[model samples]
Structures are given as structure tokens and as C-alpha cells.
Target: MAEWEDGFWSSKDGLRLHYRDYPAKAGSTRPPIICLPGLTRNARDFAPLADRLAGDWRLIVVELRGRGDSERAKDPLSYVPVTYLEDVTALIAEAGLDRFVLFGTSLGGILSMLISATMPGRVAGLLLNDIGPAIDPAGLVRIRGYVGRGGSYPTWLHAARSLAEVHAVAYPDYTLDDWLGMAKRLYRLTPAGRIVADYDSAIAEPFKVPGNESAGDLWPLAEALKPIPALLVRGGLSDIVSAGTADRMQAELPLLERVDLPRIGHAPTLFEPECEAAIDRLLARVGRAG
Candidate 1:
């Protein structure tokens, strides 16, 4: 297994944030990849991807405030995308990243688009996993139904079974072991010895406010990818990113490559062989662009 150093940085508001820093191979000149996870996910979500690609290019898997080892926000409303952008900006400066690639999943993908737009010429390559400017309403409804509903399980198997029950539609092919792995990634053992979701449940407060459920008008932000090397990974069964949205994105960004994982749902693990191959191709393009 590839090793990584635990990294910590302070957000603008003095909240402590965490990330995993994986070193690049000796003599490697490829731009480092900054990974951002989904709304409810943490840095552990990217462990598999980092294990595979870290040696070729450095990978910084970030744990946004209120998730994983990061400090929870004192104000629940601070859990907005704008706030996350600020946190990522701090990470960029703290890491002294001049130029880098972004590998964003879901909410992370939205952040990648925002970063590209706000910091032009800094993002060399973009990889958006299972997200687009316009999200499907069905997906939004499904997500809203469970965002802040916290649960506790007495054992890891119990937690895994619970997740399988709730998310079976999104991952129909997942075996018990797969669900167990996902449970570990998404939950943590508490001091009392019960398993619970790793993120701050209050992070869902923003969703309570009407019209804040989704980021409004991301198409302009998506436009930022037009001049850069980009890749979009969409799950064919995804309720979040529809086929139409992915097609529109491709039409808008002629340089963007779109990969559809037929067996997947709202998100591709990026551990999928097809996703890995597509990412390799995108990095090759980035290398040639240099």
C-alpha cells in the first residue's frame, strides 16, 4: 500500500482542516492532483484512487470542515459551497500549489468548477465524477430525504446492512463485503463504541433553507473547463447527473471527455477500471499540454 502523510491546515475562520498528502514518484513532473470528496464523504473516499495514482503524481485528498478529522463548523450554516471554496483556496495557498489538477466527486465536482472559474490558469486538468451543472430533481429529492437523518449501529455489519438497505438502488451490484467497506469509509466508531456517520449532521442545516438545496447557475462555472483538459465520469444509472446534462456538457466543452459507467449509479468509485483508464488519458493530455 502507498503511504501518505497526515496534513492539517487552518481555514480562514480558524477551523482546522485535514488532508492526506501522497508524494509523487521520484523525478515526476506531472502536476499534482487535488481531490475533493462528496458532501457527506471524507478524505477516506479517495484512498483507493490515491493508492493507484499517487506514485505518478502527488495527491492531496482533502477533508472539508465538519467532516473526517477536520474541525466541525461552529455555525452550521457555514457548510455552504462558498465556504468550502474558501477552505480549498486556503489549502491551495498552504500547499504552495502553483498549478494542479482537480479530481472532484459530486459536491467536490461543483467546487472544482468554482475553483477553475475563480482561479483561472491555475487548474490544468479537471475530472468531475458523477456531477454536472444541472442535477436531476429525483436525485435531489432522494438526497434531501436522508441528508441529516443520523443513525447509530451497534456493529460494523449492522451499519453495512443499513446502508445497503438505503442505498441498494444506487449500488445494486454491491456485495456484503462492498457494503462493509463503504460503511467503514462513511462511518466512524464513537467514544461510546457505537458506529455513526463521520460527518457533522448539522452540516445539513443549509438544506433546510429554501433555494439553498443546490448551487444556482453553475453553467458559467462549467464554462471554465472550455480551455482546459477535462474529463467527466457519469454513472448510467445515476439519478444525480442525467444523460442529457452530460451530453450538454460535452457539447459545450469540446475538449471534455465523458465516460459513462453503465453499472454504476449516482457516482463512480474512480476505482473502476474504466474510470482509471480515462483518468490516465486525461493526465496524458495534461502532460502534453505542458
Candidate 2:
């Protein structure tokens, strides 16, 4: 098992945030890789990937406020992406990270772009998993349908079944065992012994406001990635980042390395063999650039 230390830091507004700090191997000079998960996900989502890459390069897997061991925000409305950017900015300063690679999935990918745009030269490389500047409306509608709703399951099996019902389209090859493992990552045991979604349901409140569904004019943000070594992993079955959008992203950012996972859905687990290889290639390019 890859070992990591549980780390905590305070957000600018005083919310206690958490992350898993996996140190690099002794004497390694590789830039640390900072990971950010999807909107409803937490640091646990990166455990498998961390297990594979931890010692070669430092890994910082963050849990945004209201998710994982992080303190819930007093005001649910604070769950917006800009607020998340503020929290991550504080973390960068707290960890004293001068330059690093960004690995973001969905919402995390958006954050990575924002960080690179704002910080300019600090980001060494980027790995955007299953997201782009243009998000499909169908995907947005599907996500909104479940984001804030709450549910409790009597057992892990039940929870897995529930998720399989909703997401099987995205992971058609997932076995019962696979679903079970995913359930553990996505839900947590309650004091009452019931299994429930790990995040605060109120994180979904912002989606309720009209016109917030679209992320609005992100093409300019994509420009920030043009000069850096970047990788885009797109699931062929993904409803979020369509083929058209991915093509445009590559056309605009000529240096991007694009990998299409035909069997996957909205996001690639990064555990996939193809994803692992692509990431290694991107990091090598970063190493050469440095």
C-alpha cells in the first residue's frame, strides 16, 4: 500500500480542509502532482492512482470543503468554483509548492485551468480527465438530476446497486466487485451504521440557481494551457466532454496529448493502462522541459 499523511489546512474563510500527502521517493527531483477530484468526489478518488505513482513523485490529493474529512462550509452557497479556487490557493501557499503538475477530474480539471490561468508559470504540467472548456448540456442535466439528492443504503451491496443503476451506462464493463469498490469511495458509513453519500448535499445548492449550469466562456481559460505540457484523457462514452469539444480543444492547444478511452464514460479512473502510460509520457515531457 502507498503510505500518505493526512494533512489539514485552513481556507481563507477559516474552513478546515483536508488532503492526503504522499511524499516523493528519496532524492527524487520530480515536481509534485496536485490532484483535484470531481465536484462530489474527495481525496479517496485518487487512492488507486496514488498507489501507483506516490514514490516516483509527490502526490497531494485534496478534498474540497464539505467533502471527505474536510469541514463543511457554514454557508452551502460557498461551494461555488471560485470559492474552491480560493481554498486551493491557500493550500498552495500553505504547502509552499512553487511549481507542480495538476491532475484534475471534472470540477477539478476546471480548477486546474483556473489555477494555471491565474498563476501563469507555476504549473509544470496538466492532466485533465474527462472534461474540457465545453460541457455537453445533456451531461449537465444528468448531473443536476442527482447532485443534491440524498439517499441512505442498508448495506454496501445496496449502495453499489443504486449507483450501478444510475451510472452503468458510463461503466458498462464494471463488475459487481468493481461497483462495490466504487461504492466505498463514493459513500461512507454513518454513526447509525447506514451507508450514505460522503459529501454535504447542500453543495448542490448553487446548481439550483438559474443559468449556473453552464460554466460560461471558458475558451479563454483554455489558452493558459497552450504553452505547457498537457494531457487530455477523454472517455469515448462520456456525455460531458463530447468528441467535437475535444477536437476543438486539441485544435486550439496544438501541444496537447489526447487519449480516448473507448470503454469508459464521463471520466477515466486514471487506473486504466492507457491513462497511466499517457501520464508517464506527459511527466517525461515536463521533466525534459524543466
The candidate that achieves the highest TM-score relative to the unseen native structure: 2
In model 1, the clashing pairs are none
Instruction: Estimate the lDDT of model 2.
Output: 0.93
Which pairs in model 2 have colliding backbones? none
Candidate with best lDDT: 2
Per-candidate Cα RMSD to the true structure, in Å, reads 1.0, 0.9
Model 1 lDDT per residue over 152-199, tens place: 999999999999888889888999999999999999999999999999
Count steric clashes of candidate 2: 0
Tens digits of per-residue lDDT for model 2, 150-259: 99999999999999999999999999999999999989999999999999999999898887878877889977889989999999999999999999999999779999
Off by over 4 Å in 2: none
Q: How do all models score by TM-score?
A: 0.98, 0.98
Worst lDDT run of 10 residues, candidate 1, spans 213-222
